[model samples]
Target chain A: MVVMSATTLGTLELAALLTVARLGNDAYGLAVRRDLTERTGRDYSVGAVYTTLQRLEDKGFVTSRASDPLPVRGGRSRRHFTLTGAGAHALREAERHTASIWGGIGTSIRPEPA
Target chain B: MLHVTPRMRDCIGAGARARVTAPRTESPPLPERVLLRLGVDPDFTDAVLGDLAEEYALRALRDGAGTARWWYSREVIRSAPHFLRSSFRYACRYERVRLAAFLGALVLTALAVLITLSARDGPPARLAGASDTVIVNSREPVQLPVQVLDAAGHVLHITGVRYQWVSGAPLHMSAAGRVACEQRGDALVRASFGALRESFLLRCRPIRRFVDWRGGLWLAVGDSAQELPIRAVGVDGTPETMLAGSAIVRDSDIASLRGLRVHPKAPGATLVDVWVGGIVDVIPITVSKRVSTSDALRPFEFFASPLRLSSGQTRRWHIPVGSYFVSFRSDTAASATAAALTLSTVGATCSRFGDAYNYFCLAAKDAALVISAPGGTSGAREFSGYLAVRRN
Candidate 1:
């Protein structure tokens, strides 16, 4: 198997990619937004979500296809995103990098007395 | 459970009644015009508006309508700038190239027009005609020479003089100062010399000759023929053929006498005898020879005769180059009462032949008409009609 280069992703890119991967086939614009909001407990704007999705697409971390228009969405196609292998690799690399940075920090700091 | 008194129950009943009678206070839908004016991509606009509407309805049911409305307004205001930016970028992406091409074409057109206008502003020369109006024959070209003169009538030796026909006649000037006339009418020719112009009126008269019903018949049979082989036609104007070995006329004359024979005794007196299909007809033929130089001024007219055809038969008529209107009428009562006869031409084919009479407009030198029964039947169908040339 050929190994692909791992791309560096921002916080929003990684979050969106993770949300897409977790949601699987149901990962769309509004669905991803709701998932992100529920997980982070932060009110994410529609523009911020879509703009981040577009940026991730430009970076080739994710790919999107428009679904057929649904009656509930007023006949507008849904932009559904899927995580690529490169995106999964990048996510693994980011996790590994974060774990390495925090490997000894737990021992160096002590919790406050209860 | 807590025990309730009658007064408490009455107050509770009154509160429930008030709640039941209260009007709904849900927030109204967002204005579609406002969403459209946001200049968002159509897909995004639709999806976003739909998402907002769906969520708004849910929130109105769960939370209060007032809170849902505030949430919707905040979301729309926050997302407006992003949609506007994306829409602007998308529009500029393709429109920049189109705008550049349009500007380039406009500049090229302006340069071409300027060059043309500058080239037309050269020397000034006028055309002096021999007469204001000239008469010519339609059959032959007429020579009308014009001298290229300066502003003071001094002759100028110009090699390239452009000539154009304005109206009334279709005539063009060749290199040797000759006017070619195709049709007979009044026409105006204009000669231009670098912006100076002269107009002349020309009247073209049509030449008179015998109509060549058969190709090369006029040459084969000289203009002064005593007898000619004119095909014998029946009273219904259909060509009649005799049965073989039938001794209706003399054996020697039967072969020579194919059509109606004509004999002119003098300049204005003649006789014609037609015998065909066991029927005889004597028609008088008159020839008048009036010689005049002004004969070209007279209007020309064509002679049209009625022709008859049977089922699955075709007939071709030779005519001059002009417009003609042909009308077909069924002759047989059986065919006419049962179904309409179909008539078709070489150029224009009729869509349907349900009507009794069919009309066609022909604009050719030669036209052929074919008659047939319904469904390509070879029944005994007959039709007689006349075609006349339109004079314009």
Candidate 2:
């Protein structure tokens, strides 16, 4: 069995994961770029996002398809990528790892249900 | 609601003006649009980006610029929250004003319309015995624009009408026609050239301040000093006083004179009179701003692929009486003449069709012009080609 490690990712890697997960089936280069821009108020390059998407797909985290191009975009085909089950699992594991490390830390507080 | 800083408001207002004035191109790329949509309301986002886009384009056009459109996306990202708050506040205020104005105007207009309908006469005095005011001034010959509708209101295909400035400058004529005027003695005289005939008349009385009444086709030159109070007579020697003023003359204004116009104050008309020492004849008013081709030509039909050109111009090739497609590309410092553009129906090439696409390519800087014909002949007998190239 391939064991999945729970390790906290850096800000950019974590952001990339969150955007892909937020977009779900619609998670593509443009989608992730838009997701990060909306949630974090930041602009990411399409080429950079696409490259990261390929990296995530190689790690068994996402899949992509060449969708029909919009008429106004000079008919450039849109490559739409979707997060896989592995991606969702990794996101959860990353959260758990962060929580475990910060469990005993005094400054970090987790609110209990009312 | 978001508290807008004065600087932000100034930026937004400037952006709006830029959007209104910018020529239609320079829309943001797809990725930028998507990013803009994520943070701000779509309409506000579009408004802000559109303004920025126009500013970018105008700057590019004026400064001979390169692309810096990424600034729009960066700015949107930086100011998303403030923009959303401002947009929401504006929408609320605008809605309240719009509703009140709409309701109030609707009620008042309804009441006024009802009162007007109830007070209508069987025949209004304004319409009674008031002759159809034909606007014709004859002080100077009227210069008509090419392909203007004639007096019968038919589109007269005047492909060629050339005139040289002989004594005084001539005014530009519109799609309708124009009136020429001269103030002889205390009365102002007007004339208009229509269908190869001149209508000369004297202003007998001012009816509607500036409105001229062409009582007849030709109000002959008249004498006001002699025993005849009505000395003005047409070429037929009929005594007639044109109950008109020089105000109906459209497309021309006395640039030097205190008050003078060539055409009726209608839309799409320019009143341009050159200042020549207070003399109306010294100003050439009827100058056509649009340049037309020497001859009209129809494109040959049935081209599988349009011949490609590097002139930074959009090229379209249509199948005769069929749907057509246009392929356009623009680059820095391109020329229509430099492109080895050749169009062929199917794979076969004809000698006559070699120069077809060259004439159709309209040249510009850092922009593309696309035109498609909707499945019909342009009805041109002979087409001449010209290279419309301009170096920046």
Q: What is the lDDT of residue B193 in candidate 1?
A: 64
lDDT of 2 at B300: 19
TM-score of each: 0.33, 0.24
Off by over 4 Å in 1: A1-6, A108-114, B1-32, B93-392
lDDT (Cα, tens digit) per residue for candidate 2, span B317-342: 22222212222222212465432333
Q: Write the per-residue lDDT of candidate 2 for residues A4-114, one digit (tens) a residue.
A: 443334566677878877776776565576678787786654434543554565566666665564332333345566666777887888888778877886644655645
What's candidate 1's i-RMS value? 20.2
The candidate 2 chain A region of ten consecutive residues with least summed lDDT is A69-78
lDDT value, candidate 2, whole model: 0.38
Specify the highest-DockQ model's number: 1
Per-residue C-alpha lDDT of model 1 across residues B1-392, encoded as one tens digit per residue: 12221212211211121001111334334543454353424445555655665566667778978888888778877777666654554334343344346558979999999997666433445678767776553345555666687565666666656667788756666645577555456788877667677888876543322222321111111134434433433223344232111112132211223333332222332233443222333433333222222112111232334556565566544333443334455544655365544556654333322344534344343444455544446657666655332211
TM-score, B chain, candidate 1? 0.21
The model with the greatest TM-score is: 1
TM-score of 2: 0.24
